[model samples]
Target chain A: MIDKVIIAEDQEFANLSVQKTMDDLKVKQYDYAFYCDDALAKIQLAQKKGEPYDLLITDLSFEDDGTAQKINDGIELIRAVRSIQPGILILILSGQYRPVDIHNLFENHEVDAYVRKARHDVQELKAAMDALSKGQRYYPRSLAQLIKRSNTYEFTEFDITIIRLLSEGYQQNKIPDYLKEHNIKPSSLSSIEKRLNQIREELGFANNQQLMVFCSNAGLL
Target chain B: MIDKVIIAEDQEFANLSVQKTMDDLKVKQYDYAFYCDDALAKIQLAQKKGEPYDLLITDLSFEDDGTAQKINDGIELIRAVRSIQPGILILILSGQYRPVDIHNLFENHEVDAYVRKARHDVQELKAAMDALSKGQRYYPRSLAQLIKRSNTYEFTEFDITIIRLLSEGYQQNKIPDYLKEHNIKPSSLSSIEKRLNQIREELGFANNQQLMVFCSNAGLL
Candidate 1:
């Protein structure tokens, strides 16, 4: 399980540098490519040759000018490999910042680890390799923090509109009339109360006042 | 195990809002406070009363007045609880932007989950609770992306210095003298070769040429 590896980076120098680094460490078996397509092909070859690619190291952005369209981006490559071999542990190396894209990748693509380009000269890189060798996902401390910090609460647009109106000093009894005037859905008093109650229960609030306070403090209002 | 809970928030409105949310949900069994100290007291009291606190909801920052020292911030509370009770689950409610700090909290503080305080309504709050109740750590998808985008090859400070010299057009054999001139620790020629070989092996490079090319493309050259 720890014998083979493959890297799909566009930069020849990076690929060669990593190869030399691995050689210095006495690691004998590995593969490399300068584009996503070649990397994907190699992975398929490895699988067909009865030696599946164990680790896939890829750069998120590619400058492959050979193709007219951006057909072999790193994100697309990750999706491709995942579609065929869902068990393959994929790691991404990006030079730029794209939080939303990466988030979508983790939620939809099932990446096993992430490392930053800055760690090429730091001990963090060694830590990533160590973690990967153990069959455990390794995220550089920076990346872990990025992935773990978020304020995503699953509220619909309708809920937000109602909360906004309530925070503006509109009474609950009058909200339905305002909502109806604004062409909002579920513009009924009972339904509005139900939604408010649902929100209160979800946030562990005791009453409408408490819910309103929470919305205000969270900047939702 | 399912009864006691703790809230460590600095904002009075946020604190009260969460408490009210809990109350509305019919969760009258938990403890509440506006500061970390009071939260800690509640935890300690619960322990003394033979009922350990179960869930901890906290924020990372406090509103300091510049008079007295900030006592027992949310992160500190987490550390304290881990010291007193290592198995207790911790959830962080924060609005801080530094990914490194969030990473440290996860790596060192062992916070189980994180939620952001950004334009959120009650529905989002409820989703967080649902995830918490399921014994799964809830992180915003955006945060997850930040952590999972890097696949770096490790290098040491010495390697960095060497690469700097190498990038400046210094020949392989001339690197040692440059290092010595720069007050770097002297390494034998054989060791230098060995180190380069180690780098090669670790990164799975095919040869020295490959290493150089890879480094150049990755901007490490």
Candidate 2:
């Protein structure tokens, strides 16, 4: 379990909000650093002091005094930590939310989760902690749905209908009456039922209930 | 205080996802409905049965009956409930993130909170429940900051600086050195110090630490 956490962000408001959230969660002990450099120092110091942090929370943009194009900001922070301590969890909480920024955070840097500071709920940090404690990757539910929907193929109208109906607990016998009442004719009733079953089979649902839960979790329901 | 919740979403997945979340929270006794009509009926029935719901969770869109118009969406659902149960806590969880949609939810309908289905963390839902239980408004911290920065002009750069330095336990004398290091020549050092004092005065902060905590909680830090 990740017993200790370190928050690094030069922005005063963001840093304080995170700290208060941790406090509200009644976290027993933790350390916070205001700058990226000091954050690194603290991480290394913890290692030296024999009480290393299990998680790192950082923002992407910080006060960069140097002109050298730093490869690391938040992304590099994770990379550096991974180089030294590969198993340590990294979560990025930043105001940046451009698609490119999200892609870079997820694809190149391999961050455990990337939370946009602009859309964050305190539960996000707690969820990250919960995920770590439970030995699971803690991606935001919304982000997961986004990634799944964006990368996966868009659902066809018919596919949506079948899934929607099945999710509503419509038995094969009841669907035709509902479809007829709704005035849409996809095919023969058996074919419609077969297609529904086919879709369920493809999605690996054991029953209509499982399919509903699947779509619901995927944010498609 | 809200031991029971009512969900009014057309999608079975959404309804079940909410049910699962409620179950995860150990809120064992809750009810849901498939359509707005059914949901409204359930609420009325619960009221008549002397077990009125404390919260209403609804989705903005419904796939039922091939309805595409945005007229009777989540906002409409909120308005419907308000007419009968004006004091009921309402939460909108939707995939949409349009500024117009959010504005209508908060400004026009006065929803307790707007959670984007795409960005919401389940842990955030828990945190929100915690706050709601205490009768305090709970918004995702990131969203609060974004709204504060984008919608209001009350927070100035100097105010942010003061918040940052104070949060880090930097004394008044040391704050000027911190500003100078940042290369932000906001008139003279005394002027900068005066700005901090003025902010302190305006916010009714007794000390720099108080200002820092206030800003943090307000999403201004």
Candidate 3:
């Protein structure tokens, strides 16, 4: 049960909307901050008071006021809050719709959930809160699809090394010689060819060039 | 020489920051609105007075204040404003970093420029304004890179049709039958094979499956 919550949003109406959602959820112990610095200060103060917040809902983009804030954005705030309270749940509530940026939030920032502020966002926020109550992370469907699509092929170190070599203009036959020189295990012509073929089959690439392109575009190499 | 500008931002500090930028550029006849509806009304009023805005700078996300609004988001506001004054220059000023979304703004909404809110955003905003003055659209380097990467292949209608059929699990040999039935040109097996090979070479695909995957990922099909 989330007894304590803090929302860091700059917009008055957005903060009010979030408050309305919390009210609907019957969550009473919630605080709001309009800036990242204020949000960080509240979290730190709460920690010092021995009454830490259970969840932190924040927006990624904050309007810069030229006040020279220490924590400028939500990402920085999350990092600061995490350092102060390592176990606090973080839910990103913003209008950001970038798959790569959202993916980074989960992979790097350890955000508990991402709720896009859009049509039906209020309902989605309710659903996300429910999921978080059960200790499960929630991601919007589009972001989830992106994550799943990228995770379709789990590229091992061996696969990445081979792909990197191929991307560097190394021929399949010459890869074995280079691998052997580098003391890489299973550095045979057949192994290299088989691995290459396996990767192509797995990724549904028709040729080495296509595989390289996919790797490059997907940011694997 | 740019003269008039209207900044539609929700935050007071952000609005002030934009005002500072405009002041720096010596643009005197500028207006400000806190809500999209208000911005639209201002534009409509300006049109009624026979003096439409020279430029419209808006943020994509607007905090919904629970009051029913005719123009809810910047995109909707842009559309509304465009219908009123089609020749008005639009520059999106926000912290939105999504490439796909930004590309859509340029391609679909006809936004003249997008200046992300960052450390050097004030300077970039100046540059964007200068470009607009010279009749050149300005996109941040990151967004420009995305446009370039996506434009790597200008897929023809025929190519898209072929790739679509292939994505639908149509075999290479069987595509001719489907194509002939649909009255698609170059339905011969040899033609189809050569075309597929040509597409693979163009897109650096190693095989048909890779092409399908790439097409699916790229949203071509």
Candidate 4:
């Protein structure tokens, strides 16, 4: 398992929650900083001491309380850390996750993973760690899908219904039952999976969740 | 001291967290619902059984996953519960909280308390419950202050310094030391308290936290 992480977040409660997750994951070598500058300083000092951090977890925005900071935001801090320690991994734990921002982070900035600060964020963070450990970039959807804006995609009524069901919290496997009950054509589980897979491939979305969000954004569901 | 309560939130983790708090607070008769419709049904059933709920803690947004719901949103659900069980206290636990929305909720919606979903929200929830027990509203600040929008308020450099400290994670008691170290005038603890108190009273914010946010919003800090 990976060790030696630095969490740079402003909210003490959120930071405490992250620490709890780190504890649960058996990571004991993590340190925390409330300011981006402080986080950068720690990373620099660690590098100088020849004991560099394996990962950097940060929040996108930090409240400015008139305390002057060399690095004011997460983006700059990420850049600073990247220039000094090019091999280090960086993960973002933030509440702000717009599709455009996700695209920018992966395509432009070298953010390794993004775990949105939500109710099950601990689990998400754990999953991200697992992926990052395997040299995989962890984000909500594939990078190709994230960059694919709400393109004018034609949706059949069946597509709309299935996407809406997924958005409503129905698991894909369970969706066959709902479709069968409604007497929708190709209601078999295999057929449903095939159709979903086709849609996902066509839209470049990785999963049903992404498909649901995109269709909903396009006012198709 | 609330005997029986119902929580209507979709996110299982947040629901679980609330249940944990209820347990910590020794609230034994609480129930959970994943949808606003289910919550209403539970409340209605309880009312029919002559075991009406004492409190309703709910979120403003519920995921619209294909399930048909009479109560589409939290506001409508709150109104529905208020009509059937007029005596029940209602508390909103939502992540989406803006100053204008807070004003509308207190002034027009008759919500008993509002606990924004954040880190340390459990403590905030406990504080809200204490206030609700005494028949006082629990919100970030008073209703009058919420309705008062950002007017042209002049701020001295000294006033900015203290609020800045508070925003930067420094407690009010710690401000005197920073002030004294910097050779700022009125560096005593009493003086610091008095100044913060004056600003809080003038702006009608209840605590330093709220004052810091307001001043920061107004670009004073």
Q: For residues A166-207, could you state the per-residue lDDT of candidate 2 as single tens digits?
A: 544455566677777787676457877677578656665444
Q: Please report the TM-score between candidate 3 and the true structure.
A: 0.48
Residue B140 error, candidate 3, Å: 2.2
Give the lowest summed-lDDT range of ten residues in model 4 chain B: B212-221
Per-residue lDDT tens digits of candidate 2, residues B7-85? 8765443454567678878875788876677777788788879888899887776543454443355667777778878
**What DockQ does candidate 2 have relative to the true complex?**
0.02
Ranking by TM-score: 4, 3, 1, 2
Tell me, by DockQ, which candidate is best.
Answer: 3
Worst 10 residues of 4 chain A by lDDT: A212-221
Cα error of candidate 1 at position B79, Å: 44
Candidate 3's residue-wise lDDT over A12-130, tens digit each? 54566677678879996999988899999899999999999999999887877668888778878888899889999999987654444455676675899988765457777889999
DockQ of 3: 0.09
lDDT of each: 0.64, 0.63, 0.77, 0.74
Alpha carbon lDDT of residue B125, candidate 3? 85
- DockQ, all models: 0.01, 0.02, 0.09, 0.04
Candidate 4: pairs in clash: A168-B65
Please give, as one word, the docking class of candidate 4.
incorrect
Select the stronger candidate by lDDT from 3 and 4.
Answer: 3
lDDT ranking from best candidate downward: 3, 4, 1, 2
Better of 1 and 3 by DockQ: 3
